[model samples]
Target: MAITSANQLELLQTAEAVAREKMIDPDLVVQAMEESLARAAKSRYGAEMDIRVSIDRKTGRATFTRVRTVVEDDMVENHLAELTVAQARDYLENPEVGAEIIDEVPPVEMGRIAAQSAKQVILQKVREAERDRQYEEFKDRAGTIINGVVKREEYGNVIVDVGRGEGILRRNEKIGRESYRPNDRIRCYIKDVRREVRGPQIFLSRTDPQFMAELFKMEVPEIYDGIIDIKAVARDPGSRAKIAVISYDGSIDPVGACVGMRGSRVQAVVNELQGEKIDIIPWNDDAPTFLVNALQPAEVSKVVLDEEAERIEVVVPDEQLSLAIGRRGQNVRLASQLTGLDIDILTEAEESERRQKEFAARTSLFMEALDLDEFFAQLLVSEGFTNLEEVAYVEVDELLVIDGVDEDTAGELQARARDYLEAANKKALEEARELGVEDSLVAFDGLTPQMVLALAKDGVKTLEDFATCADWELAGGWTTENGERKKDDGVLEPFDVSLEEAQNLVMTARIMLGWVDPTELEAEAEEEAAEESSEDATEETEA
Candidate 1:
């Protein structure tokens, strides 16, 4: 083939058409064309030659050229790629050290192999452009619902043909009972959009809790308008789901609005979810009240919440236990997820049994630890003494509130509690000393005698050893072994310290040994004391 002005104009028109069809920039197509032609020219010309090609944007004229840079004789590694200033000055009026010397070269005829290679290059560029386009278009769609056609299914995963892109609905992301065939129209939540080496990956999900919430947002106008809000959603995917809603407008009933006129709105969401049962409940600010609402269709007699543990213990009527817990405990499990609390459900009978057992255990502990008779232990338990520490620390007035207890009896009880604690501490300190614990460590301000004993048993016999130990080692955290963090709690047995207490104690030891700056230590101490004072003030207010 011979190059002509008309053929060059036709080439540029073809490049423009290809660019339009591929949805890529025209300049990129032209660049790809130039590269392909240059590569094909390299096959005919020497491969070592510095070949370059440019296509005129205006006329589509193809210009083939070779580039060589002026260099010193010693710097010239390839004669074809570089020309000494002496040789370069022959081609130009002035030759600089880094100036490129361009020479025109004739275009080479494209063989079948060369043309195929050029086609592959254009296709690769077009694919990359498509991927970039898709990523930009769909990345913002995450956390929202999208409708698409099921293009294909591979090993249980569906490839959804979203407009201008393909989304992957992995097997696990699909609803448990839902299946799709080719060309089946489906709605899914865009869980994530990721840029990978191959292309942009749009991950769709039908089981995500956000998916259900988004569906409600679409069906319920109140939610979208902010008059009503979906506070939280928990789903078992195919079988059941629960949504907690709250209304900002006092007149609007969030649950009633979500339920629609005779449950049409919730039913719409249910229909979209392949008939999953839906429970719409109003959210409550109080945890106990919220928990009662969360466990619906079942009567709850009482709820005890442990805010520190983020746990709720619900006592239900014996007959309602089955209903409250649901089949296989799904109801309580979903309630837990919706409320963000660990829920333990029990019947009134079970709670009573547990209470009796706990009372017995506490009475036995008080009797053994403080040498109190069963009657005195019962009085202490009745007055709400759960631990020896409370007995040792409570006000004399609190102990006097026990029936038949005068100020003298209260003073005696306090005396016995303190005596017992002191004797136990003295025995533990002696044992720690016998086990070779350093006096500096035993005398550390924040470490208790029991803590010292536990440290000595763990081979932390020196102040340096105590300072070097991590808080988790002294208190509780996930156990790490073999470079893997396992789920085991590091509750340093016999010491009974919490993570915060362990950290504080370790920090105190470090400060005492001059391992930490006293200024930082003092600041931390001030902050901790302030927090303690605030907590005491809060308790006083509550009382």
Candidate 2:
């Protein structure tokens, strides 16, 4: 239909209605309407002409204009849209070659087909505006909690009506086998917000560990006020959860604050989570201590942390083994998640057996390799000499201090130990050479003869090959795949190479090959230090 005076206000009215219904700005809808009208006008006024439309915000009056550009006589291509400068002088006192010549045009009488097309354009723009609005609103709301009504369930996925938009709580994100009917009120963590081609996706989760932390934040005033901080959280969905918290205020107990008086604060969160048991532990800077706290109700005899491997060994009394490991290892698994470590739990008896096995193994090695008697091997093992290298290189005085070991005996022991190591090195080198080990890698300073053989066996036979290896490949590491920690066996892991040592060795090799620049590395180190310093200062100020 035409933009008549009688229906001029109808355009603004429709824009307001759509904007209000979609919870978007009216200006966006009005602009969409103007463009749609201009497009419809173009179809009627000849597609070659540039048609423009303006709608008054206050009066809702529609104004249409026809535009043509003045060009050089030879450059004029379309008579409908462009005119030569000489021909434009008839319509204007002065017309520049690039200037637009605009004139008011009568509104187009839109046909049924044109009206439908214009309607589609307005709808498309409104849909885009709504999507933008939803994305903008929920993007920052990630890592937070939201309450909504369950609208429906499709293929086991819950669609939640969150006021202005719908949130999807996938089946995998639900706590256990939790089910809901239509119109059921629910609370979930906004795990992610993505703007995809179809629309903005608001992924809600009830099983996320952060969901529990946020619940405590909501119920615990100390946490909301920043007197207490939630350091970490681990959850088994509806079964159990653990939260590590720390108090900045000396007067406040972080655990007690989260637990509340008579367990009132924690009770609320537990009820909301379908009775999920929560253990609120005080966070500690010391990892082992923190792990001990994480595995509560289980008495830990000892905690040994391997920082480079990000793993920990926990020894408990025989009676507490079941408790420490929990039902199906739940307790230790949650503790590992909270501490970000791979935990290996053992009973006191088990640990003792392991130590005895190791001691016996060392004694056997000395007896066989050094040609020492059983008693002498036991004595050497008792003195903490676990390897031939240690025995060969230890101070002579250390060996002399051992009972019944004189200067001659110490010298003899060193000679035998060194002879065995020398023979072993020669054998390893021969094996490496047979496997096509390169001279460049063998002459490399850091790798031992055994290490070279191992590298050759693993197909890393050259300096370039060694330089291309990642530090983790040489030091061994843990990887999380499909949410389970898997051990990655490194070529040099058997030699007890730490990640730091592996990094240094690889970088040294790279520098020797001129693949890396020392000056650039120094500059990068300085930049990293400055960034770390700035971050620390910012954190201090925030605290």
Quality of model 2 by C-alpha lDDT? 0.94
Top candidate when judged by lDDT against the true structure? 2
Q: What is the TM-score of each candidate against the true structure?
A: 0.87, 0.92
Positional deviation of residue 419's Cα in model 1 after best superposition, in angstroms: 2.7
Quote model 2's TM-score: 0.92
Once model 1 is optimally superposed onto the true structure by TM-score, how far is the C-alpha of residue 332 displaced, in angstroms? 1.6
- Residue pairs in clash, model 1: none
Score each candidate by Cα lDDT: 0.87, 0.94
Q: Write the per-residue lDDT of candidate 1 for residues 183-294, one digit (tens) a residue.
A: 9999999999999998999999999999999999999999999899888999999999999999999999898999999889989999998899999999999999999999
Give one digit per residue, the lDDT tens place, for model 2 in 1-543.
Answer: 778989988888988999899999999999998899999999988899889999999889999999999988999888999999888999988888899999999888999999999899999999999999999999999999999999999999999999789999999999889999999999999999999999999999999998988898899988999889999999998998899999999998888888888999999999999999999899999999999999998999999998877889999999999999999889999999899999999999999999999999999999999888999999998988889999999999999878999999999999998999999999999999999999999999989999999999999999999999999999989888998878999999999999999999999999999999999999999999999999999999998
Q: Report residue 267 deviation for candidate 2 (angstroms).
A: 0.6
- The TM-score that candidate 1 achieves is 0.87
Best candidate per TM-score, number? 2
